[model samples]
Target: MGLLMFYEYLSRIEALIEKHDDIGLHNYLDAMHAADIAEVLENLESDEQRQVFGLLTDEKATEVLEELNSDDFSELIKALTYEKKVTLLDLMSQDDIVDKLNELPESRQKEIIAFLDYEDAADVKDLLLYEEDTAGGIMTKDYVSIQKDYSIYYAIETLRAIAPDAETIYYIYVVDDAERLVGVISLRELIIASPNRSVESVMNENVITVNINDDQEEVARIVSKYDLLAVPVVDNGNVMHGIITIDDVLDVIEEEATEDIYKFAGTSDEEVYEHDDTLFDRVKNSVRSRLPWLVITIFGGLLSAKVLASYQTTISANASLAMFMPLLAGMGGNVGTQSSTITVRNIATHMIEGADILRTLIHEISVGMLVGMFCAIIVGTAALFMHAEYHIAIIVGISMCANMVTAATIGTIVPLIFKRIGVDPAVASAPFITTTIDLTGLTIYFTLATMMIANL
Candidate 1:
């Protein structure tokens, strides 16, 4: 539908909701797709949402429920009957059910799990053995798999019989008798292969897989890097756990990106999402989350003041140095922030391993040196134009170069240390980097000025 037409359709539904026209609303929503109905439900008030949801058939409700965001899904579930909740949960995919269940209390989780059918209950229990952030936690066991010894004809026929129940049949994985992942074959390959040929012959034996314990973000990275539709999950022994599809990876990508963005700002997602539903409460939560980081910055600023106080003898002789202090500090702070952001992002993508970390460190330092030289000339010229003394201009220029190089070096090393110590680089890097660079940048500029001006 056109944008205007869709909103108009939504308006009509909301109008019906206002009028309490249940029959009309039910009839109207019946004609819309489940996803559209889900969108409509999200836009409605809680009472209105439950009213509309109550009108949906079980099958349609299952589809609509799957599409709702986590917060909305949890709220909606709270208003359902125990039987209705179990029925809908039973209709969901094993991985999706586990995801929703994880958000509930431990007692509630067990109660819900107990109501699931035997096989699904077993799958949920098995999947729960892995932490929620790991590959096994997000992977689904519903993908099609073929025995490597099966003939092409049998494999194709097997897929035809099982494809309806499978999450994705784009690539059918091949496992040996030991249930070990040995190969993978695309749907097109299966169709074109000679019927007499075995599944092992045409299947690509070099399978790209994630270990069951691998982090969900790592799984997303592998999927994105390889342009894969689905990647198999295996144990250290090569036994199959399940397959993680592209759809699940999309959620992981968004979660990781949101987390990194928040951490870069010196806060977290929980401070934002885990709050009472009020404008004032949210504002308070956000302020609380940021206060500690800002407090640290305040202390750093005080230390900088102390550093400047000790250099009064130097600044008194060359007051022009005070003017360029901001220029040097700003340049260093900006460069450090840029370098640290890149390092954290690369770490998230698993690209900064043993030698790559050193390569990244050196590469950033080299860039910093070149960039510092370019900025040094500009700032020096500006200092001269401002009619500052020649020595002051020269001192600021040299300090800018040194500070920039040091800023980049610290930015690279700080995140690496955080990662080495098993700390989340994103969560811990930015505030520390910003505070360190600001303190040291001023020290470098003024210390150099102190030494240079003394000789003059």
Candidate 2:
């Protein structure tokens, strides 16, 4: 259903709750999908969330909880007793449980870990050894594996026993006696193949896998490129560790994208907005997030101001020249922003390489020249209509063209240089690029005005 429909349904449920209709609320929640339930939980008050959650069965509740984001999950779980938390933890996938536990303090993490069964605790401990942004950190241990020597019938039976608890059984992995990944067979192949055929004979040996220490973005790229349901994580010796499912990759994609967006806007990762945070909290966070960037931008503005001040003599002689300053600077900023944004996106997606950087910059500068010519004509016409001196018209037009060309060149090169030096291109944001252009554009405008108008 669309967001509107979901909100409408939530309103009806909220009215029922207000009327003390437990049966109605329970029935409503029971009928909703886990994702929908999670959405409702996100918007509800603390007590309301707990009340709604209580109506769900253990299995359904587990699914709903898993659908919630980290903040929502922590808040909802805080209302549960230790025993209830333990029950819920047991029902979750190992990777998800690890993620949830990692968000808590060390004492709380230990408390949560103690509730798991010995084997589960051990698995979680092993997973916690990896950094949160690595393949091993997010890869679930709940994948079905069978011996390569097993017959199709035996593999099928093995799947039946494990499918109840396994996160994904679509691709059954075949490992050697040493527990090293040897091949993989899809569930369709296992079901349709001759019952007595050996797993080794049917499995595809050329399996694509990621190292346990691989970055999550790299893992996401590999999965996207291969169109995989899950990719196995392996050690140096090809010992299968765990499998990163498509769902985990989706989470990583969202996280990385959000982080990049925040960085582009000149903020830290913690500044990403949350729907549930209080108004005060949001305002406080926004101020904190924006202040650092604002400070840097202000410094850039001061430098531009200094350049303008240095051209005071020329401005005093021809006050009309100052009138065109904003136009030239604004056009330069717009052009630079457009060029840099595209370059940054391409670099992020691995579409731009070091070899392509020069070609990309040249193309952008060429585009700038064409765009600049049109802008200069428009601005020059407007200046002439304002009854400005012919020299003023000529200087303003030339300044606009030159500023735009310089803006495009600088914008293209700055991002590529950042990428080459291992800096995120997204960090070179519009504000930063615009500030740079402003200073340069102003200097060019004043210098040209001084020379052209002096002769007139």
Candidate 3:
């Protein structure tokens, strides 16, 4: 619905609730998507949120809970009675239950876990042992698996019995007696195969799987690379654990991309502020996110000042050199930022591997050389037009070319070095790159002025 339409619905909802019209409230909410219902609940006051949420059927409640953010989901569940909370928890997927419980306080998490059946509780507890950003943590325990030796008829029968509880039936995993995943077969294959055929006969033996401890980003990369709907997670012995579905991988992609964007802007945490947040809240969060980066930037400025201070004699002798300093640094920083962003993106997307780094660096340097030559001619001509001395114009031209080449080389190498050392390439963000370029570009420009200016 449009904003005005949603507000209209919200007013009607509040009116019905005030009248204690349970039937009217349920009828109104039941027709909306879970996401729309979540949007409405988020706009409501705490008490109103609870009242509107309470009107949802048990199944609809589960759907809405899944659609809500971590904070909103926790708040909604916390408002429920103990029995009602447990009932909702029981209806959720194992991964969702673990995620929700993790958001709660330690004591509350224990209390909620106690309400689960022994098996479901054990599964959730085991899932909790994995890091939140790992493949094991995101994978769901609900999937269809069949013994490799089983006949097609038996597999079909087995699927009929377990399909209701499985998260996906598109790909059926083939396991051994020990529940180690050995192959994978599509449901389409199973349906077309003769009843007498063994699952092992049709299953693809070259199954692609991820280790439980693999990073979620790596999991996403694998799923995306193979165009898979789901990839199975396994232990050291290849024992089947769970499957990471495409939907979860899509979430990981969005989260990682957002994180990279924030880091590029010098923000620390990965939060994207909502439009509905209060002004004070946004200001507070904005300060919290940007303060550390600003502190670093402040120090960088002081360092640049110190560099300028050291060149006092050089600038005092040749005022024209000072005039050109900003131009040199500005061009270098712009070029460096461009190179670093491309390198970081290529690394993150796996387009450039370790073996490809050397070639990539060479290509960047070649482009840098071409860019530097073009910029040098333009800047030198501009300096001459501004009535600068011939020697000063020549020095500015040479400095611009040298700075651009150096800046581009540094930008290309820094991200590769960070990745080689197992750090996120995005940590060498735009702000950081620009600062480095500024200091180096200034130093290079002054040193060239000292050498090339005849009066100096």
Candidate 4:
């Protein structure tokens, strides 16, 4: 639905551009939603983007500019004139303006800051003081809050006055005499209650709130856990600063998912899927994030080599052992990776809690056991035919069972241990699990072969 709407709008935008110069184009673009315009702008070439942007009203241009990804925002800022940039900055929300400013170089950011209105500039400065991945960084200072003493009638009128500027009015926070957050009331309740009822009487005291210092991922987890529309943010004194809305939480979720995916693939979180970034810049980002992981994996491989070399005599005496080595190691790695992936994802999403970690481990172990038993039967039968030795069959079956069980156990435990140590479980689990399984599988294969086959 959104794509179709955007395509229809883009066709209209294109037709308008053909018929009219910048001024007329600007008028048409100003009438569209910021999100729709952003979609269209992103689809256009650089030259086309400049042309379309030239046609937009200052406010509309800023809205669409702020809606773009960081890479696109940086590009758009470079294309615009100093005067136009100042005008766009003036029109954007303080939070959005700060975000854009943060993406620019120091000199560019200083120049833009100089052009901002003193009050707006201060808000941006304060927001920029926090780390980018905190509740303080993403929140807006434009949320609706009312004194607890106001009657529902007065509150309604106040909401009407501020509704245009506020990002969301779903939950109106109630602050006390010292500006400390005391309670909250939903817009639905406010509308349904008696007009004369005081906000203090109607509001619920048990408000869910997050501190400014809380991690953005933690903020997202809280919002998702409580199924909240918006969560208030407060300082140590309980003074209301801003509220993190569902929209912001959604953005956090996307960012966290992107970060985890990049980490898994040995890439950086900053690598975005936009054309605005240069090839060299992309490669720089990729290499910086990936090289360390590759180096670590190299060491892991060396460890595996040392383990295999330690059993050189076993492999020399029975060259057939070398044939099944790759098979056993490969299967174990696959199973370990599968378990770790599921466990890490479940833990990150909060679907699996700390208390349930043991249960999840047991469940995964059961799955691994079933899988191992099935594979052991198949491989054991195959070994009986190929080697015509009952001892080789027993050795293969026992090795398979042991390796699978070990893989499953390592896969389940590694992520949990990473979580316990305050490391991102997803980032550390996969490689570690695969390495452990490789070492354990090779040891089991050789040890079982030595004991069982030598007796036969």
TM-scores of the models, in the given order? Answer: 0.89, 0.93, 0.91, 0.88
Best by lDDT: 2
Worst 10 residues of 3 by lDDT: 268-277
Candidate with more favorable, higher TM-score: 2 or 3: 2
Return the candidate ranking by lDDT, descending.
2, 3, 1, 4
For residue 417, give model 3's deviation from the true position in Å. 1.4
Candidate 3 lDDT, 1-456, residue by residue in tens: 689978887888889989999898999999888878888787788899898999899999998898776668878887888888888877888877777767677787777788777878898889888898999989889889999999999999999999887878999999999999999999999999999999999999999999999999999999999999999999999999999889889988998888888888788552466546788887888898888778887888889999999988989988878888878888898889888999999998899986789888988888888899999999999999999998888889888998999889989999999998998889887777888888888888887788776454
Question: Which lDDT tens digits does candidate 2 get at residues 8-120?
Answer: 87898799889989998888878889998888788888888888898888889899888887777877777888888888888989998888777777776786788788989
The parts of candidate 3 lying over 4 Å away from their true place are 1-25, 81-87, 270-289
Give the poorly placed runs of model 1, Cα more than 4 Å off. 1-10, 20-36, 57-59, 74-87, 274-284
| Order of models, best TM-score first | 2, 3, 1, 4
The CA lDDT at 51 in model 1 is 89
Candidate number achieving the greatest TM-score relative to the actual structure: 2
Residue 408 in model 3: lDDT = 92
lDDT of 3 at 371: 93
lDDT of 4 by residue, 49-87 (tens): 788877776767777887886657767877888887777
Clashes of 4: 1
